[model samples]
Target: MSFSAFRILAEALTGHGGWKPMWREPEPQARYDIVIIGGGGHGLATAYYLAKEHGLTNIAVVEKGWLGSGNIGRNTTIIRSNYMLPGNEPFYELSMRLWEGLEQDFNYNAMVSQRGVLNLCHSDAQRDAYVRRGNAMIMAGADAELLDTDGVRAMYPFLDFANARFPVKGGLLQRRGGTARHDAVAWGYARGADMRGVDILQNCEVTGFLIEDGQCNGVETTRGTIRAGKVASCAAGSSSRVLEKAGLRLPIESHVLQAFVSEGLKPVIDGVITFGAGHFYISQSDKGGLVFGGDIDGYNSYAQRGNLPVIEDVCEGGMALMPAIGRARLLRAWGGVMDMSMDGSPIIDRTPVNNLFINAGWCYGGFKATPASGWCYAHLLATGKPHPVAAQMRLDRFERGLAIDEKGAGPQPNLH
Candidate 1:
């Protein structure tokens, strides 16, 4: 049922018992026109857009676990289009635009908060670099503003601006960029897709692919054999393992990226902030907890747990940026397996196997790129062509010598 103010009032008047589950838990069907692997944000969004935008509803989004139980639920919830590269900027801008109208379009309260995102610059060189990045953001139709030390101080007065080692020189601010409720995004997509006649199959793991004569027509799952006209894998961290079953080795390495939240405090950080000297970023949740994260683990692994060194490194960065943060007690932390591509960019393209598509290698940008990723993937699956904004996110970009290395961190997954 659609949620509305009248419904709430009626439910409240009637003892508040009219609420129902967001989406149904349907059993897997034998066949579908399109089968999407993984029930995370991208998969559910692909199914939703395929039905809403492309008018194709015979889709199945199969998941190994409960819905939103992946990177979609394990993130700092930041969203922005502050990219510098042409290959990445436009696509993220599209995602940012989509995020602006997502809750209204899907009729759900995903909490798309545009509280702004500030990227601090610790040195003159970093400030100059942020100036260039801000220009690029403006060029891509995204909002950006270069903020001096005083401007940044006006926003976040508690920052360690006097640190001699890494003094805060300036920052790049995206007035329209901010955070969202990550799990609610997944739920809204799932509910929208299900309402439009797309099947969401949870707890049904894809064991293998139904490939014959170099074409994939279905998948072999833990439940049973399911046939499909086309199969798309949006498996995130499990991309390599899932495609390995089809004998396709990806250039993606799996690394665990950890995130943390602190004990509740009075409102402090009104917007997202990133430390320039290090890879730490943080924002305060509506519930008063300070949510933050840092770089991925240095090693390659599929386990959704992080090492201590990375945690220490992240905490150090946080303390370095805001000395007062050291006083807050750490409440808890969690990790998500990141599919880091060689050049630290995502890949969304048709694989070598006919009728089989792949959407993986999102690295650290997956959560922010959810809407555009799904929109582009659905466009590709429906039209057999890449969306204009996502044309550079091909699986063979590295082979074609066209890697979109956003960080200029070379081809190392650990560095990006």
Candidate 2:
């Protein structure tokens, strides 16, 4: 049902009992025009755009488990387009624009908040780097502002501006950057796709790909053998294992990235903030919990849990930035397996196997780039051509030395 003010009022008057399930639970079909692996944000978004933009509803989104059970529901929910690289900035800008209109487009309340994101700089060198990055963001038609120490203090008075090692010198602010309700994004996309007649198959694990003579015909699933004209893999951290069934080895590594939420407290943070000297970033949830995360575990693993050393490190960074955060008791923490590419950038392109496409290597940007990733992947699957903004995200970029290393961290997956 379409949600609106009138609908709410009607439900309120009628004892609030008219709500329905967001999406349908359909059994796997024997055949489809396309089969998309994984039912997270990217896969659901792909199915939505494929039906909405390409008029192809004969699609199946095959998920191993329940919807929104992956990284889509396990992130810090931050979103932004403040990038610097020519290969990365424009694509993220498109994502930012898509996020701006996503809730309206899907007819759901995804809570796409634009409360702004501030990246604090701790030294003169960092300030200069932020200035250059801010200039690049402006050049790419994205909003950015460089704030001095005084300016940052004006916005957040509680920050430890005089830290002994990492004193706050300035900051780079993106006024349009903020967070969203992660599960709602998945639900909205799932509902939109279902409304358009796409089959969403949950609890159906894909065992292998139905590959024959260098062409992908469909997938072999636990439920049954399904045939399709094209098969796409949007599995984030499981990309390598999923594609390996087709005899393809991806240049990707899976690492666990943990996120934490503190006990409910009075609203203290109005926007997202990141530590320049470290990877810690935080934002206050509407429920008043301080949600935050830091670097990924420095290892490869498929499990959805992390060790304690990284947790201690993240807390240290948070304490270093805002000494007051130490008093807030930790409520809970969870982990998401990140698909880190060699160059720390994502890949959304066709593979050597014909009729097979892959969208993985998102690292820490998956949740933020959900809409654009789906939009671009849908464009590629529909027309067999890379979307203009995502053309550089080809699978062969590494061999050609065209890596979009936004972090300039070389070819190390852990560092990115």
lDDT per residue (tens digit) for residues 1-416 in model 2: 89999999999999989998888888888899999999999999999999999999999999999998999999999999988898889999999999999998999999999999999999999999999999999999999999999999999999999999999998999999999999999999999999999999999999998889999999999999999999999999999999999999998999999999999999999999999999899999999999999999989999999999999999999999999999999999999999999998899999999999999999988999999999999999999999999999989999999999988899889999
What residue runs in model 1 are displaced by over 4 Å at the alpha carbon?
A: none
Error of 1 at 406 (Å): 1.1
Which residue pairs of candidate 2 clash? none
The TM-score of predicted model 2 comes to: 0.99
Query: For all the candidates, what are their Cα RMSDs to the real structure?
Result: 0.8, 0.7
Q: Which numbered prediction scores highest in lDDT against the true structure?
A: 2
Q: Rate the local accuracy (lDDT) of all candidates.
A: 0.94, 0.95
List model 1 lDDT by residue over 1-416, tens digit each. 98888988999999978788888878888899999999999999999999999999999999999999999999899999999999999999999999999999999999999999999999888888999999999999999999999999999999999998999998999999999999999999999999999999999999999999999999999989999999999999999999999999998899999999999999999999999999999999999999999999889887888989989999999999999999999999999999999988899899999999999998878989999999999999999999999899888988789999988888889888
